[model samples]
Target: MAGASVKVAVRVRPFNSRETSKESKCIIQMSGNTTTIINPKAPKETKSFNFDYSYWSHTSVSQNYFKKDIKMK
Candidate 1:
């Protein structure tokens, strides 16, 4: 890894829209191996809601309970 000039990994997580009805648009940009996630269509948060996007998401639960049907969904 001596001559490495770019990041080894790039991870991104999209915004959870279930908390509110308003939708959002996001744009992802990458240059020189650097990636940036931008939400160009960011909407206003009008109400209070709790969404579990951390660890207990649907995809994770399905993966843990059923390992054969996971495809990054």
Candidate 2:
């Protein structure tokens, strides 16, 4: 079980290992270890929505924003 007010991030660096030399990445924003991955398959620098999650969280609140368990609903 996980705490209701906890926010843990699980990141997976999946290797292409195929013809494509690009090493892909996968990021997941887990809520209480629930593993609700938003972009489990996204091209990091090439993706347009990369800033959709991290950007808003950083720009919208202070470092202590988690003090209230705040999230973009």
**TM-score top scorer:** 1
- Name the weakest run of 10 consecutive residues (lDDT summed) in model 1: 47-56
Tens-place lDDT digits, model 2, residues 1-73: 6756654433323335662366443343323223334445452423222222221232223432122332244
Instruction: Residues 1-73, candidate 1: write the lDDT tens digits.
Output: 8986642343335457663355543344333333444445553422222222212122233332222322332
- Cα error, candidate 1, residue 48 (Å): 32
What TM-score does each of the candidates earn?
A: 0.26, 0.21
The superposed Cα distance between candidate 1 and the true structure at residue 25, in angstroms, equals 0.8
